[model samples]
Structures are given as structure tokens and as C-alpha cells.
Target: MRAVRRPELRLPELRPYDGAELEPEGDYDGLEFAGTDCSGQSARGARFMDCALRRCALDETVLSRARIIGSVLSGVRGVGTDLSQAMLRDVEVSDARLGGVQLHGAALERVVVRGGKIDFLNLRKAKLRDVAFEGCVLVEADFGGAELERVTFDDCTLARVDFSAARMKDVDLRGAAAVDIARGIDRLAGAVISPAQLMDLAPAFAAQVGVRVE
Candidate 1:
């Protein structure tokens, strides 16, 4: 990693923070930042609305108590980052890497994460509404104690993922591969897998139900 420097990127209602790495900073509401690097920094209580974060790296950054409404966070890597108590609405995160990211107590409404690698991502005690995970690889991701409503996992790889104690309503796990479904079923409490998925997960089904496979 090179020396952390804030780049010149402009967004609506957004301004560059001029200072040596801020702590205990204020909020940034309705701001957009493009091609910026806020990596390895801590942004607490920052609120962004109608904002766009293009090609930004928030890796190892601490974003506690932040709220983003209708924002686009494309191509952002949040590896080993903390986003606790954050609220996101109508957000889109594409081509991001969230490996080892922690999102405890976060709330998301109408959020979509596409084409991302989210290994060991933590979403404990999070509340989700109308969230979609599309074309992503989620290995060993944790969703414990989450309240999920209308969440869809479309064409994603979900191996070793845990959803124990998560409240799900209208959640769809259809069209997921057999190995992925097997991992998901390990921690599923209140969810339904499609019949087509059952056929694909025959190996796991046999293992779970004590049925011998010839």
C-alpha cells in the first residue's frame, strides 16, 4: 500500500476533507465522491444521500454509525472493514471485495450487491429489507441474528455461509448450485429451498436425512 492520499473526486453536496486523517469527524450528507481512496481510514457518522463512489477503496476502514441513501458504491473494496450500525437504502455495490468485513447491527433497504467476493463477511444483528445479492461469491459469510425481508440470492455462490437465527420472509434461494445450497441449508432456520434445488442437493439431502445413495 502506498502513502494514503485523498484524490480529487467531486460529488453532489460533497467536499474534500482537508486535514491529516480525521477522527471524531462530522457527517457528509448527500455527497458524492468519485475515484477517491478512503482506504485504511475511519469514517464515523457519515451520511451520504444520492451519492456515488466510483473506484473507491474503503479497505480496512471503520465506518460506524453511517447512513447512505440511494448511493452507488461501485468497484469498492471493503476488506477487513467495519460498518457497524450503518443504514443503507437503495444502494448498489458492484465488483466489490468484502472479505472479512464486519457489518454488525447494520440495516439495509433495497440494497444490491453484485459481482463481489464476500468471504467471511459478518452481518450479525443486521436488519435487511428488499436486499439482493446477485452474481457474488460468499464463502463463510455470517448472517446470524439478522432480520431479512424480501432478500434474494440470484446466481450466487454461497458456500460455508451461515444464516442461523436470521428471520427471513419471502427469501428466495432458487437456482443456486447444489454445493451452495448445501452450505446454506446448514444454517437456514426459516427459509425454503426450491424443489429443483433439492434435486441438485441430493448428496446433502442424503447426508441430512440419513438416506443411502446408490
Candidate 2:
């Protein structure tokens, strides 16, 4: 991994100076942490703009009510972090660990989560509009009470994911495996599926009706 460039505090783009180890002591705006270790910290009502967090360990960090825009978080380990009430837009987080990550009441737009084990994630009451999950493992994830509009799951592993009480509109599940689709039946809230997948699930449907469709 390439070394991230340090932010010049005197630059006009970066403001409200806060050290890597020092907490802002209060709500701060436009905080930046590039090429640093900010693990096991609590940042409340903070915002990170144009930050590059490469190879950093943000494990067990609590970033409630925070917003990160246009950030590149490559190789970040965000295990069991609380990112509730946060908004992440135009961010790319690949080769990262997000296990047990809680994103309740958060909104993700145009974010890419590729090649990561996002197991046991809590996305309850979250709004995932225009978000795409590609090539990621979403095992036992809870998407309950979420508003999923125009969400696309492409080539992703969605085993035992929960989407209960979510309002789904125009959700695309094309190219997703059949095993993954079956797990999304009750969890899909009110989302619609393809006709081919519906036809393929005839046997499961028949069994529910007390009929053997062998």
C-alpha cells in the first residue's frame, strides 16, 4: 500500500485542527485523519471530507452522528464500530473488515463495499438509497426497518440477511445465486423479484401448500 499524504494544516481545504491522538473535546467540523492509527476512539458529530484512511485500524470506534464524504478507506478494519446516524457518500471501502458493524439510522449513497466479510452487521432503520453491494459477504446482516429504494445487489453473498419491515422499491437482485435469494424471502419486506426466480422457487412454494411438486 502507498503511503498517504499528510494534510498540511495551513491548507485552506483542511480546517479545525485535531491531532491523531487528541480528541476534539467537542463537536468538530471537517476533521481529517490521513495515514494514522485512530483505533478505539469516540468521535461524536464529526465530519471527514476528502480523507484517505489507508491501512488504518478503526476497530471498535464509535463515530455516531458523523458524516464522511468522498473518502477513500482502503484496507481499514472497522470491527464492531458504531456508525449510527452517519452518512457516507461517494466512498470506496475495499479490502476492509466490517464485522459486527452497526449502521443504524444511517444513509449510504453511491458507496461501494467490495470483497469484505460484513457479517452480523446491524443496518436497522437505515436508508440505503441508490447503494450497491458487490462481491461482499453479507452473512446474518440485519436490514430490518430500512428504506431500500433502487438498491442493487450484484454478485454478492447474502446468506441469512434480514430485511424485515423494510420498504423496498425497484430493488434489483439479478445474477444473485438462488440459495441467497431463498434466504431473502421473509426478509425482503415487500420487494419484488424476477419471474425466473419465482418459477425456480416453485418447489419451496408447493411445500408450503402441502403439495409435493417433484
Candidate 3:
């Protein structure tokens, strides 16, 4: 019964940017861009509604195809922020210090990323639905070919997280404390982990199915 690849955000009926200087196709509504700097701004196709961006710097900002609704990005210090094909709905990114944030083909719905320290966050081919990354510190976060649904990674610290060719459904890392999967463990087929994260990833799934657990 796989039918929850949601992300068709439609929030572009705005005319209230009220700018203090953020003008590259700008259409921001209900704006409150506190401490705005918008470093190296491009902001292509920008359309943010209900916006509240505090401590904003947005270094190397591009925001391609942007469309953020109900946004609230606090402590924003976006480094290499491209946000390719962006469409984040109901977003709430707190304590942000986005590093290498490209987000290729991005389309996250109901996103909530708290206590962020995102390092190398690419999200290649992204399409995450109902995303939740609490207490994040995602180092080397790639997520190649990503398409995760109902994504959850609470208390995260996932070091060297690549997940190559990812297509995880109902993805949850069981309140992740320390997940160090550098590449795809068979793309984490139908991911929904518990049981102590499958016994702490069972020695990297028994060395990728060549089991010899003596």
C-alpha cells in the first residue's frame, strides 16, 4: 500500500513582501526577516509565505525555484545554500548553521529540523515527505537519490550518512544517536528501524551479508 509520496505545496498568492532589502524575484508574505544579511543572494523564483527568518545570513544563497510556506528559520547562517528546486511546506528550521546545503531537487513537506548543524547536507534527488530531524548534527549528509517518506531522525548525529540510491519508505532511524552508514546498506529497504537500531546496525549488516559472526 505504498502511496504517500506527498509534496505538492501550493502557496503562491502573495503580495506583501514588505522588504528591508531582499529582492531577487521576491514575493515574501508576512515577512519578519530579522537581522537579515542574505549573503550572496540570488533567490531565484522566491515565494515565501508567513515568513520569519531570524539571524539570517544565507551565505551563497540561491534558493532556486523557491516556495517555502509557513516558514520559520531561526539562527540561519546558510553556507552554500542553493536549495535547488525548493518547495518546503510548513518549514521550521531552528538553530540553523547549514553547511554545503544544496538540497538537489528538493521538495520537503511539513519539514522540521531543530538544533541544526548540517554538514555537507546535499539530499541528492530529494523528495522527503513529513520530514523531522530533531537535534540534528548530520555530518556528511548526502542521501543520494533520496525519496524518503515519513522521514524521522530524532536526536540525530548520523556521521558519514550517505544512503546512496536511497528510496526508503516510512523512514525512521529510531531516534538516532549515532548512525554511521557511509553508503547504502542495500538502500535500507523499507526502513523503519528499532530494536536498538537493529543491534546498532549489526556490524554493518554483517559486513553487507557476508556473515561470519563468530
- Best model per TM-score: 1
Query: What is the per-residue lDDT of model 2 for residues 1-214, given as tens digits with 9 covering 90 to 100?
Result: 1111221222136442445562423343444455456678877667767666666777788787788777666777768888888888777777777788889999987677767777788889998766767677788888888888767666776776766677787677764553343333554534555688678656655665578755
List pairs with backbone clashes in candidate 2.
Answer: none
Best by lDDT: 3
lDDT of 3 by residue, 24-56 (tens): 778877667777787887878789887778888
What is the lDDT ranking, best to worst? 3, 1, 2
Candidate 3 structure, TM-score to reference:
0.35
Compare candidates 1 and 3 on lDDT and give the better one: 3
Model 3: lowest-lDDT 10 consecutive positions: 1-10
Per-residue lDDT for 1-214 in model 1, tens only?
1111112223456554343452534555554566667778877877776777777777787788788777788888767877888888778888987678888899988788888788888898899877778898888878887887777777888886777667777677774553354243554544567787778767875776778888
User: TM-scores across all candidates?
Assistant: 0.80, 0.77, 0.35
TM-score order, best first, reads 1, 2, 3
Cα miss at 142, model 2 (Å)? Answer: 0.6
- Point out where model 3 deviates above 4 Å: 8-12, 16-37, 40-58, 61-67, 70-79, 82-87, 90-99, 102-107, 110-127, 130-141, 144-147, 150-161, 164-167, 170-182, 191-207, 211-214
Worst 10 residues of 1 by lDDT: 1-10
